[model samples]
Target chain A: MSDTFNFFEYYTHISQEDILLSYKGPLTDVLLSEFSRDIRAKLQEDRRTGKKVFAIFMEMAQNVLYYSKEINHFGNNDKVGTLVILNTETHYKIVTGNLVFKSSIPLLIEKCEIVNSLDRDALREYKRKLRSAPSEHESKGAGIGLVQAALTSDNPLEVKIKELQGDYAFFVLGVSVEK
Target chain B: MENLEIQGESGVYFIPTVKLRADTGVCEISGESYLEDTSEFYNAITNWLEQYIREIKKPLTFNFRLTYFNTSSSRSILDVLRVLKKFQEQGGKLTVNWYYPEDDESIAEEAEDYMKDTGLAINMFSFEPEE
Candidate 1:
């Protein structure tokens, strides 16, 4: 066995690891079923390793379904986004990136940072306090889902943002669970 | 009063099916809940429970068999549990049973969190999926 690896060949192989799943159609009831089917397959593979991976997968998938803003095929009313699950040698990484309004990025990043800093006990307490509070906005972060995802994953969440034209930005979150 | 039934969706919101009985005092909220408008969808259920606690003034049993719910829905669920807790505190009979999947530890922990938050006795049931 040689220690040196071919860069181009390795890059091609690594790119194949990227699993892309996108939805852009009518906002009908079947959309849930379709998304569930794809997620279930990924989850089954995660289940073979442990429960934590499955939990992380569920949280990320739900976020994409709930928050993605780029509409395709369907009218503007439909929810849209891209979700990718990649498998490395030692960990399963979930990368979910979606189009969100530029104004929402700051708040979203703030919440992610807050959740990433908290320990499990503090996160649980935070969830309790938010639950007790009154609802303000409909789907904006109440700091529950991201917190749950952080608690479930072994490492802190990795987030990146890119400017995508006027009044819109691409938000990407990468979470990994040990296999 | 008529029963409340809303369809569940994946993208927008999860609609939880609600069945409330004034006569027997049995209330059941089952199915998944990940809704677009969490408060708007659950406000009716909370209002109905309030009316039941005030007018009917009978013993109540709440059964929750939700398979999956997002974070927003979970907050609304806490609201529902709080209403039940309030009724129990006021000398009203109450019981809550939360059924969860056997493989899902998060759900069990969530039920425990609710129990701690409300200071109410809740029966936790572990269920195995049917083959």
Candidate 2:
């Protein structure tokens, strides 16, 4: 519940997976630039392999920028969150953690369930349907962004919710794009 | 009037390339778009498109070949599509073509979503990276 929890503690728990690059900072354009450079390098190493790693990375990074609750003075006015990328022997995993009010959990869970239940083709059709629907409450439930993330990812989307203090929850989403 | 073009850079946000031809009303928006100020970056394009619809009133052709764009940019893209929809309703001839990497199904889906959202007909094309 306390905002004083050391971020270093969280960093220590990252799995032993090979990290081509690790960045912890205010999510700003500057940080994104640096992060993109590192990711581009790693992606280039496998560029000839026909992997769409950068597109997946861009989605994860945007989620962190828009959903993270921890704010610093340096970054853009987007939301605050922590984002990490792990490169295993055969795939790349992108993890992002952000805070959302407890009230929104049900809606979030429903959206995820609906997205997960569909195959790639169905998901694409659903995404198109949502996109075409009139803007409800100013584009909050469009769900197009998350659907796009799922379609880009080869593995099923993984979502974990951890209860924080009174009305806040930390939501962690993991997506894997195969090489 | 004149074609609009913007270059891409690092750290400064993705500047989408815009090519609008007054003679033919053909506009193409390509490249990556993740701007620090989404409204500021896209305002001009939206306004230009609006003016073209009001003044030029020619058959409009739009081509989208963007590889990456953030959620905020997505909103602006919707705005562009909405304008085209309005123009079409007013008896303006409009055609939209969306190009995506063959492997990037997400982009293709995004284009489809826009078409569905606006009820506009769009031709979708897939391009594979050259070997």
Docking class of 1: acceptable
Docking class of 2: acceptable
Per-model TM-score (chain A alone): 0.74, 0.79
| Cα lDDT of model 1 by residue, B25-72, tens digit | 888887777665678888988999898888887899998888677677
Candidate 2 residue lDDT tens string, A1-179: 79998888777765454765566656765677677767777677566322455656666677666556667655345556777787888878787788877888898789888989999878877866665556556343346667767877746779999998888999888877777
Per-residue C-alpha lDDT of model 1 across residues A1-179, encoded as one tens digit per residue: 58787889866765684443443343333565555556566556445344465446556766665677776654656666656667667776777778888999889899888878888888887777776676458555445667777766747889999997798898899888776
Clashes of each: 5, 4
Q: Which candidate wins on TM-score?
A: 2
- Pairs in clash, predicted candidate 2: A68-A80, A68-A81, A69-A80, A132-B117
| Segments in model 2 whose C-alpha atoms lie over 4 Å from true places | A1-17, A48-51, A73-80, A132-142, A165-167, B1-3, B127-131
TM value for model 2: 0.78
User: For model 2, what share of native contacts is present?
Assistant: 0.36
